[model samples]
Target: MEHEATRITGTDLDPEAAFQRRLGAVVQAVEERIAALLDDAPRRGEIARPARLVAAMRHAMLGGGKRLRPFLVIETAALFGVPFAHALNGACALELVHGYSLVHDDLPAMDDDDLRRGRPTVHKAFDEATAILAGDALLTLAFDVAADESSHTDPAVRAAFVQGLARAAGLGGMVGGQMIDLAAEGRYGDVLLDEARVRRLQAMKTGALIAFAVDAGALLGRAPLGDRQALGAYGRAVGAAFQIADDILDRESSAAAMGKRTDKDAGKGKATLVGVLGLERARRERDTLVEAAIAALASFGAKADILRSAARFTASRQS
Candidate 1:
């Protein structure tokens, strides 16, 4: 199975099956890493770990979605011949930040979501304060893991990971984009969401971290400047397509199908390409981005077919 799974040739087996096999491996590894990170035992320089806090953090991190961000890190690192073991912790760190974002995103003051991954959200399953703390802890733990020597041998690479992730999650990136999204909802005042503004919001909110995920792999392997730029392009294209696909899913998918509320984007007046470009055009744009993402990998040749498939899956994913 290991031999079969590592091979990415199109004719060797079913493409979707192979892609899913690789993805499942990443999800399993990330889940195990997260569980270990949230364990009851305190690490060096930490006080006693609180049981409830650990449980809340565990609930927010474990048994969740596709873990696509981690997959991108691991897979892209492999493109540069970096072993998965070397990349695993960094991948886990990125996913930890993603989990933290979702926990906070589902808060009463934010999207106010009740269900996530078909289960009660952190705030719903636990308490709001606990949920908030869990998010904070998860975000902090991400930096911990990224800073650890296990993530990379070079201090420079680890430092880059820390700085890059902070930038991706900080004011100029996901958090700022979230603020813009909320303001666009008329939470503060009237904010016109033209196509340009909508695209910018999505790029910052969703694209930044995703682009970081791919770039982290390049950093991990210390890839050349040109290769790094190529992966960056791929990540940006996929990231944009991802948000467009999400908006389309919100409009067209059922709550039961999505494991969360649907039809809420329009109701909240959230800035989305689907809202600005209409469903048909949004879909066309997504397809175009998928192609562009693939084209960005042209320099990597057959080694990047898995990534090419990933771009397709991102655009066409039902959930």
Candidate 2:
């Protein structure tokens, strides 16, 4: 996945443009890998076959968005000189898990959204039952993708990938955070959660999977223990900053700009940094977190230039 910058390749381009070219390469690689994975899945005829479910899963997982999590996995893996093909399996697995989350999160019982990435959500495009099943299938398939022998020749590395993804995507991480989120908004019952509780919720719900993406890549590459720890810190800081930036965008931007509904958190009584710290302070905090995240990668030098750019983008993004 290394792109040598030459005059023919636009080495004369601005740093942002050059960086974007690299990012685009990662995006295209992962998208193609994911598509192939779906197309080649084990298919059986009727008698409870998964044709419709596969269709739903494919609809939700492919041809969309920034694919930032996959980029993190690929770039972190590259730090150890891992081949692009070696990283593709894990990158696609993480994207599947992310796609699953979004599918479930958009359910009528969850975020109750009608659109995602400017199209009808899985639940709306198909039916509520199909959406739920598609999400479940995606989550389960992620582990299978990680366990594939081609992902890593070493069984131990493959095992680590599976274990890491489960922990990050499970109760201690994203799903657990979603539970807290639902409760905080009184989906279960009334409860006045404080700033600390809300912050914890955001960290687990959003930050956990992101941290896993970076740290798991380091593990798959067998990077030094110290390097793995640093990447973990970077992931957590960037994850929090990402949520804060999302809050700002939801408050300040339009639905069309975001390609989804905006300004809905307040209506749902969701606790966000902007609500707790106010918009100005939240923006400052996000900026500070971005700096902290970039500092965590200082030891990597220019090898981690893409990661540094990612943190900066997370802090300043409008949608």
Candidate 3:
């Protein structure tokens, strides 16, 4: 045990397996917490709404997925010795935002998909209006969850969490990237959306929330400003790699595996690194970004191996 604590090494079989198992547990824990919160929240006015709206929101929120964003929030907090229960309380907010985004994204006005997490999309399961309302409700609930005082001991910490969530899920982040994505359609052959633009769009669309997830942990734990900043940078890098992996999967994987439509980006003629650069080049870029993400954790020494494993997993994941 002493040797284990003092050992210094990169990600190996044991750590990788441990990381996967931990991620699985964190995903389950976050899902359970979010469900319970949704169930009990209306009594507290945390999120009160019609039963139909609540059901739609529940449909969109609780389903099968990686829950990677929540994983980041909890594990990063653990790096600073924050208890999993405390970190989980705040991390659920990010997952709500993510679920909201997915629900709306699959609407006829957006990505227009009919499946999510291997089930009928909210819009398809109910109606378009219900799906829209569910997304709006979830987004509102996310801020409420972030600001809840019970999640943290300090008011300032709760404020930071709320503010961070706003920025990451706001116009400058996910929403803005989505606008770029919708606008970039069919501009594949044009210079309107170059590589840089696409990457920025990717950063905003996917990376911002991820960076916020990792940063949320540090904020709740009151980690040093310097370490928090480093983790933010790490999150951005890992987020990029994660998107690139998605691009790869879209090109190669089946819709059954992803539980949603595949090749949609290419079909839309959207700008992607895989479409801009070739597959090999995108793979190289993803690898490079993963290394950068890992490098950003150097400040944490051997203790950061879990994060390193996460970055590698982002680049290598099949779905």
Candidate 4:
């Protein structure tokens, strides 16, 4: 007899399997390009002092991630008719910044997660000091990669792109989100977090990088202001929906299903949509946000199919 399905047992139809079948090609192409860029990243020279730090940096950066941010960059660029090669460095840079955040977020002082992407956390696999340095290195190197003029034919446009990325990855965006997350833990104990406040947190934390991804792609493709605005709206909606879905999965999904620890949010007293809204309401909100995300892509016509699929996947993903 065939082995019973593990995580997905009830239904004969597998949504994730179908999604992977449709998205696997795009994901593979994006992964290969990202891997090449990562492999080419310089870790260290013959210099002795920083060699260990370089090695740590390489280890953390090379370790696994979904590369979702980079994929967003590539997909958005494709929607606008930009060549994937032209946006590869920007996409890679986004992934580097994202990886850096994960490394730092996994530290004992932060989320204190021992596992990530089904592997030992950076701080666990490597030492704590090494993980810290690795995160810093990736964060700094992301800007360096983005600023490389050789990647783009137009130096002026490349400079603008670099500036945009810096702003997004720095205090105004991802870093700011992290700061808020750190501050909010256990502050308002047992009080129901209002929807607006949760949305604010989600926008800064999760939505910022996503918005950056779309904006960077639009810039690379020389898209008009209208197109950029539309894409930005799409990113924000889907990004928030993604986080909400994550909240749902954290409560309902098993550890094996998530490939990481579950219920950590509730354990930490963190504010989430599920924490604020009831579970049923949270699921409804996610669906609503997903619909809004898809609607935002309506201006793109058929070219936005990949983005539409991504939005649906974001709301429906078990992982």
Tell me each candidate's TM-score.
0.96, 0.93, 0.92, 0.86
Model 1: how far is 270 from its true place, Å? 0.7
Model 4 has an lDDT value of 0.75
Q: How many clashes in each candidate?
A: 0, 0, 0, 0
Q: What is the lDDT of residue 35 in candidate 3?
A: 84
* Candidate order by decreasing lDDT: 1, 3, 2, 4
lDDT of 1 by residue, 12-130 (tens): 65656667778877778788778888899999999899999999999988988878899999899988888877899999999999999999999999999999989999999999999
Off by over 4 Å in 1: 1-11
The alpha-carbon deviation from the true structure for residue 49 of candidate 1, after best TM-score superposition, in angstroms, is 1.1
Report the poorest 10 consecutive residues by lDDT, candidate 3.
Answer: 1-10
Q: Could you give candidate 2's per-residue lDDT for residues 172-205 as a string of tens digits?
A: 9899999998998987889787889888999988
Cα lDDT listed for each candidate: 0.90, 0.85, 0.86, 0.75
Candidate 3 vs candidate 4: the lDDT winner is 3
Question: Least lDDT summed over 10 consecutive residues: which range in candidate 4?
Answer: 1-10
* Candidate 3: RMSD to truth: 4.1
Worst 10 residues of 2 by lDDT: 1-10
Please tell me which model should have the higher lDDT, number 2 or number 3: 3
The runs of at least 3 residues in candidate 4 whose Cα sits more than 4 Å from the true structure, single-residue gaps closed, are 1-55, 187-193
Q: Model 4 over residues 1-319: C-alpha lDDT tens digits?
A: 2211112221343544533543554455545654555453454542343656665656665645566677678778866677666677888888788888888988998899988878788788879989998888778778777877745778876888888877776787778877667667855344455778778877877788888888888888888899899998998888888899999999999888887899888888787889888799999999999999899988787657767778888887778
Q: Arrange candidates by TM-score, highest first: which order?
A: 1, 2, 3, 4
